[model samples]
Target: MQKSKSFAKYADAEAFRAAMEDDVRRGRYHDPHQESRLFADVAVEWLHGKLDLKASTRSRYERELRVYVNPKWGAVPLRAITRNGIQQWVEGLTTGDYPAELPDGRSPRPLRPRSIRNIVKVVMGGVLEYAHDQRWIVENPIEKVTTPRSWIRTTTRCI
Candidate 1:
């Protein structure tokens, strides 16, 4: 992870603190999309490292790639993923088809939507937003799918 230089060159104590506070007061916390958008791999790499996030956030990205992504189309090249394909992927999650790995390295039951939605909301959401900014695609795959505070549960199990 790289140190944030988004705020710099303020020598005073109170004034510097105030200016930092102002940036947060506005909705301008971090702008990851201000860089090049045509390169998908670069954006992915940056999302893994360049973004200044917490440990749990980084773990969420890993989960997004593993639980929600890799078992299906991860092997395919990034350019081959079309808009419709992305839509289908999101829909697939609703069916509890997500693969799972046991602690003993054996494959377990597929994950429910409740387990999958967090990765979709946090991890995949960031990737889609970054891809949109990079101009790698016309629009974000996860666009219009708002993140919820809590996922809905079903009678059978967690949904």
Candidate 2:
């Protein structure tokens, strides 16, 4: 198959072509067309493909996808989900910086670090990892994302 891309600078175009050739040689090339799939679609597919998850676990995964992941990433194409974007999303969760209206029609609120981590792990991790496995993306952006510390230790114990 042949693909064409336009770059404003010839050097940039050459660099991109060189990278593509190297990726192809190393068997790391991913078809650009697959990256257009929506995140919600991929997440649903990934969740459904897990046959061994406990009922409760599956329920939680679904909830996380609906409440957290989907609201932010549902309509976005897989190629647009970058590590920086994931990092910003995580920061927003911690800071209550989301839009006023979420999918469930409730106002956004800051989530605890532990809760944020679980959402990232169970929802983001599962979906992005699946995308990588499907060759929809060249790499899992979540691998580079870091969540905030879950909690701070208290210096003194309660009496």
**Candidate that would win on lDDT:** 2
* Candidate 1: tens digits of C-alpha lDDT, residues 51-158: 677887777666566655656654554455556665565565665444543346764444455565665655655666665555554556566663334556567766
Off by over 4 Å in 1: 1-43, 82-84, 99-114, 144-159
Measured over all alpha carbons after superposition, the RMSD of each candidate to the real structure, in angstroms, is 12.7, 4.7
Residue by residue across 37-131, what tens digits does model 2's lDDT show?
A: 99999998999899999999899888888877888899999989999999999999989986433555677889898888999965789899999
Off by over 4 Å in 2: 1-25, 99-105, 152-159
C-alpha lDDT of candidate 2 relative to the true structure: 0.87
| TM-score per candidate | 0.50, 0.77
> Best candidate per TM-score, number?
2
- Which consecutive 10 residues in model 2 have the weakest lDDT in total? 98-107
